[model samples]
Target chain A: MQDQVRSNVVEILTQAIPSLESKDSFALAALSDRAIELAAVFHDEDALGIALVTYAFGKLVSRGGEEKPLAPMILLLQTAVNALSSDDNSAYKKSIQRLTRHIQMVDNKINLYFQEILEKARIKKGSKLFESGFSIAAVASLLGISQWELARYVGNTTVQETQPLHTLSVGKRLKIARGLFT
Target chain B: MKTLVFDSGPIISLTGNNLLWILEPLRDAFHGTFLIPRSVYYEIVEHPLVMKRFKFEAYQVRQQLEIGVLTLIDDAKVAKLGDELLLLANNIFSSRGQPLRICQRGEMEALAVSILKNASAVVMDERITRTVVEQPASLQKILRHRFHNAISMNATAAQKIVTTCKNISIIRSVELATIAYERGLLDKYLSRKSSAEERSSLLDSVLWAVKLHGAAVSEDEINEILRIEK
Candidate 1:
């Protein structure tokens, strides 16, 4: 029954972040239901879990109109998302057991779609960082890629071959270096 | 004149360690032109200036360019060679179904420039590039371990790479920095109150930091450089 709810919520989800709160609860409810199905389509379980966690957190915001401690929720959701993505069903079940610890973390209303958008943004930033000549390991750590999956995405792209624009002139640099040294 | 080609890593290492001042003196002492490929200039000079954190280092390099201690060459001049080398190098490492791109375009351009100019050496700090150019067997072994299989290149292509790499000497920034220190170029910037041991330790720390930052110098190699009797 819970599986049904998880897979039914966000079937029609397609909007980006920034204007998430004004989005009606019907949409949020839909996201919560279709989380698993969305995960399969995007091949990303963690992001959908992030979206769901944020949805729950968003609910508290709408009710009190104040910021709440969402860190614990974020952590729990991340674990659950990873569990879902795992091939082992026993591991997924074991991970979901820890979710009970965050039962009182937030109220029922969540800004679910907002969290999904945030996850997508993080992935985007990860690719950009990799492209900028940062080591693959460093970027992978930052993006929380579990199995060198980021490499496959990044390896396909080639480095941009253009001259970067210089903001500071040579004279200014010499002056600065001299001033700093002197 | 004999030439020495530079990649972006060593230059960035020098700047990051507050040792850009040594370049001019080193260039003045060496009897060869210091060549910087366009891609390298883009990496070390143009890219850094736009970002606030690296603007100062970028400027320091610009000063070197302004003073003619470093000369920029169009990458187009060696683009054909660079691309060929890049393709060959990647193919050599593509032991598994997946291809490994060990060197960036900038690094390839530097290698191209080194070959075209008949450079005395290519001062670079990237481990894979250094290994491929100077020690192909080591690179092949590494690729074998990475792919968990035997890696091989066609005899003709292997011969071609070996022939091209023979004329190119690969040195790390640690060596260049050591050379600069030995020639007393760093004395003006560093304090005189320190003992020789302290100076050596300071140099090791700076070189180690550069090694960590991305230059290919291994910990063992760094230790060897430090233990050298000057």
Candidate 2:
């Protein structure tokens, strides 16, 4: 992993541990935001993994899932943080996987919930990347989301309205198009 | 021959709005080729063909391809130019030290084909691609606003892309809808008692349909077109 990504991951994990302990759903929200920022900048799977797990944690906390089920996941997060601090890349990867699987194993309902959150997160981040000037096709490809979904999401946003008009007026463009057709 | 290269945005917008049919009449009238890069073909047709939700729309676009309303262009030269263009475009803007990737192969390939074919224009509905080519300064402003960070521009790269694409004109699916209306192709929707108000309403509906379907056109632009048509 890149140094910037590594440090950011460590910081997020460190912050997230306390929040998860207190069941501070709002802190999870902030952690998710930071994770998303990291994901957006790096456009890497690791950052995206961080984002997904953090977001899922936030959702789970807000839903008031049983505390016992999540306790092990906190240990996994700590292990991940320690592995990163020790520059143990393989261990860090394993910890992240174990953390995700722990969440999945909590319950079938939680698994389904995680799946839904994953999909929604992909679309939401994909739209943000599109607004960041990435092409719709590129963002869709990057996020493994469908162009159809991205297009629909983008259409509802004000990104288009905020852009400056094309250098040519609508009439001039229409005239040019008309001339071509003729 | 006159030509128009299409990006995936306009294709998605048109197909979503069921306005893909307009391309046939418009192409017949233009007496020119409508080209889509192979990458774009995959984006609008091949990739979506397997997805259950969008399979029918993919088939509709594929039918247009089979009927020759849209032609697929694949050339190593276009691909090379496209990659080069993509690198330049993505590198033009950066937040902090990391260069922002703004354009992708599908969009850039369409642009490459246009630059090589000397097409009359590129029909695209993505604001960023259009803005990058037409006005990078405004694009920088947009990036700063969107990212809420210190966005920097590489003048050399921006100048190169702007100079490279200076001759390429861009229009949206919204414009295509308007063109269809102006050419009387959309008159089929008119009632027997069609009046000026009815025509205006028809134009309004068409524009809004494209807008709602993903054409990068604003309501103000639609109203301006309506006033111009009146």
Candidate 3:
């Protein structure tokens, strides 16, 4: 959450986390985590998810010489949210819906972003894959893909067969999803 | 001009764009030889999660592929770290660098190569995990998107990568997308089209990834770019 909250996160989630908490059973990790506790109160998963996404707003920013600082905790927070969204146990329904929306928005923005950089990394006229001698791995990473996936999806990649993507158990799924999205 | 080292994230994004065909052209197009340290090959190819994709690509570039550097892992620890390292990691501390406690050879080599070459850039999406590793001062360089895309999808940097990749060469965009269509990559892309909501969700991920990473285009963006080119 942005610093503007002003309220004590521990106090707020103390009330909110327990709302879903069973007196006899509880998440020690969650209870112990100050971030979780503060976030637990807003328990409206969707709103909190939105607040976390405020980070991805900048695509590219370059000035004379200052290097960019890491984006605020928002990206890390979203990754955690993504991990949780697929977990049925930890997932609140509202959160998943919100998360799905966020991914869509991010997807929409990636293209514009890529076009911007290709412009900067423009190659000398008439270079081709065979000539560059750059490994496929380098190209794949430049594009934000796993080498395996890159080999599979790229044309004439000579990539192997597609293995089915295994489904995650509900609780585990939500945990992972939460890590990624919210 | 800085040199970039490729990692796994950009590869996955390409499958979505149907741009794998471009690999052939790309492999032929660039001037400097790109690298995929041997350790990187093992992490992405040997691991159960990434293996299928790895094997598929291995066969394609089998003729051209060359080992850049072998990741020096604590042989003893590699066995122990096994699955944990595969899930995703920034760095693993191995007080017990005994046999069976392996760390990612891929990560080590990638870093080592950067340092050895006094290279200025490293392109790794997964490195910003809970831990970090020490490196020679020469190894440090500007992360390609460090200035733009990574922090957020809304930055000016993010906008540029997307637009430029969209226009890379109208002719190549189609050829690349078609190749992706022939492969199962299109299936994964279409399956999500089940709903606009799903489509949008996937799209945002592309936008953010492109901004942070380089011009690694997404399936949706490739499709859109090709359609525009057509």
Strongest candidate by lDDT: 2
CAPRI grade, predicted model 3: incorrect
DockQ each: 0.04, 0.61, 0.04
Candidate 1 chain B, run of 10 with poorest lDDT: B93-102
User: Residue B80: error of model 3 in Å?
Assistant: 19
Q: Compose the digit string of candidate 3's lDDT tens values, residues A137-170.
A: 4333332344443332232321111211112122
Fnat value of model 3: 0.05
Q: Between which residue pairs do clashes occur in model 2?
A: none
lDDT for residue A119 in candidate 2, whole number 0-100: 79
Instruction: Give per-residue CA lDDT, model 2, range B89-119, as digits (tens).
Output: 9889998799887778888888899999999
- Using DockQ, give the best candidate's number: 2
RMSD of each: 14.2, 2.2, 21.4
Using lDDT, rank the candidates from best to worst. Answer: 2, 1, 3
Better of 1 and 3 by TM-score: 1
lDDT of 1 by residue, B33-81 (tens): 8899987787667865777746777888999999899999995669888
Q: Estimate, for each residue in A39-82, the C-alpha lDDT of model 2 and write its tens digit.
A: 76677778778877887788778888787888898999999999
Candidate number that wins on DockQ, 2 or 3 = 2
Alpha-carbon lDDT, every model: 0.55, 0.85, 0.31
